[model samples]
Target chain A: MAGGQERILRRRIKSVQATRKITKAMELIAASQIARSQARIAANRPYREGMQRIIREAASADPAAARKMLATPEKVDVAIVLVIVGDRGLSGPYNSSALRAGDRLVHMLQHQGTRVRLFTVGKKAPAFFRFRGLDVEQSFTGFADRPTFADARAVAAALAAPFVAGEVQQVLLVSTRFVSAGSQVVESEQLLPLVMPNDMEVAAPTGLKGYTEFEPEVEQLLTELAPRALESEIFSALLEGAASFHTSQQRAMAAATDNADELGQTLSRIMNRARQDSITTEIMEIVGGAEALRSGK
Target chain B: MASLRVEIVTPESALWTGDATGLMARSSEGQFTILPQHTATVGDVVPGVVRVATSSGEVAFCVHGGYFQVGPGEEPGVTRATVLAGIAERVGDIDVARASRAKETLEAQLASPGDLDDLSRAQLTGALARAELRLRAAQH
Candidate 1:
């Protein structure tokens, strides 16, 4: 029942309350960003789908030539892995999950005796991989939160060079995919050796099938479409990663805010109890002194 | 007179979506114009101006490399023209000064750099072309 103890508890409660405010504000901001990222993803869909459609048509035009060369390579030698994470932290395990998945993939490739070139997007990936003695071939940052098509093209160029030069056999991407508002999963997908969408193959527009002619030869068209397709895929991954990051951050901040609130409540209760005890002790002391004075009289 | 539903979409946003009596686009083969009832076709869009004649007036768009598709719509003899641009800017929204500065910078970079790799040089050339097209579209 010490007055000093009561004051210390009050101060601790005040700090907890202040922290709760910050976490709450961060939660709101992350929530808003999730909505914005979702909108961006929706807007980009038509362009991405259109690119895919064109590539599919070109590939179908001469499946033997285009698919045989562009779709798959016969052997495996060098592999390029692009790992995407968020630039900032406090997003729960969003960055760490993707990095961890990427690390496992890298190690697995190394065990297979394949040379792996690591390219990272976002600040977290480079630092995380570098700390583990992994060499990052290239790193891009400063726009993971809201990536532009130009950023995607730049990244695609870096990834494409090795493959185009016959240096890398395959390209893989690791990132968190935003499945829905409530669910996000870390995944690794193949980027190189383009996998044509099933719908693209099945639903070839019959009317436009042989009528629509390519400016260049279909093989040449496939060559031109490859880079753009890769760019769009990377861009989509970035957009999904950004949305997933925001969703993770919002949830993490909300949980943290709730924990802070609980801590504040517990501290307040303890502080109130201490104050009550101190007051009771003070009143007892006054009563004791009065009793003593009255007894003496 | 029939009209076609036109949509100009970029990755960032949908720049324009409306009905147009006619539209002109530059493809890899050459420049072509689409009037109503154009047959179903798909072509590679080159970087340049895309002009659309709407009910109000003619509007211009600066489009980067993309795809153009004319597909049959729900109604018979009605086609939907979709321009899926990697990047697109409305002529009205174009900042003439900014585009000019960008073009100048790209030109300078393109001229002074023998050290640039072929790929980088080509990218720069493409960017310059896009900037020039933007400026041109803005002017008319």
Candidate 2:
């Protein structure tokens, strides 16, 4: 019985060692990915700032022309929601958090007598919603890891089409916002008919702040600013999400590696003890057999 | 000084910051010109040539539609306009072979017509625009 137990312990030790090797490799990969994601986030900032400044300039030029572009429907009967999440699992609760928030928002909107239509942007969301007996308008996969501007534009047009033709009163986007290296929070933002937040435009940085004269008219310029504003917002969100995903994955991998190391240590101790016990048993059998031979003589 | 302080920016980096004699741009309404001490205005740009009438001569660039802001903060008389041009590239900036290869790939994809849905169509168009920008700008 003891020998059988010893054999099992030895086998467990080998398996644990193998697992440690995998976890350690994953940790390294995630660490490298974090740097790339952060670089992309940094590069996207100037474009985002430029887009916002232009939007402000346009809105200021002609609040009237902006009004034509920024028309808000009186009552929202139908609404489109874009839910962006991750494709794969294993990075804590990144996808689940978005999924739950999206569901809750949809429920709240429905309660307000507004019809909510849902579009998903990751692979994970489809099965999750389907399992819960919810209908998904569209779920696009394979783009979550590396989202291009075109991917953003595709999602944007879906939400915009309804609002543009009076199908949706409002369009909202739900995504994860990367606040810092150590933290990320899920955020739901308005995407269409940009609500011009006062005081932000005047707070411009690195902008040709002190100069610029409009040639034709102010209102005409703001018209161009609205769509560009939406595009910038989407672009920034994608960058943030990419950064946050890598950060979370890195932390998760580090933890996994540590756990694997601990398990390996425990298994090593068990394996050593098993070898010692098996050797003692072999010695006892040999000594017993010699004593029996002496008694027969 | 020709008032339009033309500033062109691409996604990768800023291209040019200089003065122009007169600026002609393609807007949503139509082609419009910006002159020194022009009134405050905003406009939507369509893809076309941006003609900068400079003191020495005129220089034109193949420009994609973006946002242009004139007299953002100035008090009307002093023309301080900033054009937040989008994806502006010198014809000489792009490598011909690379752009051509990209175009060929896109054309093949279009010809094969696999899921040439709205998404694919937009992707192809973007490829064509980029190639055209490179070819047109690099020629001169």
What's the DockQ for every one of the candidates? 0.57, 0.29
Off by over 4 Å in 2: A67-74, A197-224, A288-297, B1-7, B10-41, B49-62, B70-86, B98-130
Task: Summarize candidate 2's per-residue lDDT along B44-90 as a digit string, tens digits.
Answer: 56776777777887767667667665553334334544445545665
Residue by residue across A1-297, what tens digits does model 2's lDDT show?
777887787788778778867867877876787787777777666566656666666555445676666656677788887788887776777888988998888888889898988898889998988888779998877877667765666666666666667677788888999898888999897777676545534644333344444534666455445556676677667767767777777787778878878887887787778778878988999999999999999
Reference-based lDDT, each prediction: 0.86, 0.70
Give candidate 2's root-mean-square deviation (CA, Å).
4.9
* Model 2 residue A93 CA deviation in Å: 1.7
The numbered model that scores best in lDDT is: 1
Per-residue lDDT for A194-250 in model 1, tens only? Answer: 877655457555434346656656776677778888999999999999999999999
Q: What is the lDDT of residue A157 in candidate 2?
A: 62
Give the Å error, residue B129, model 2: 4.8
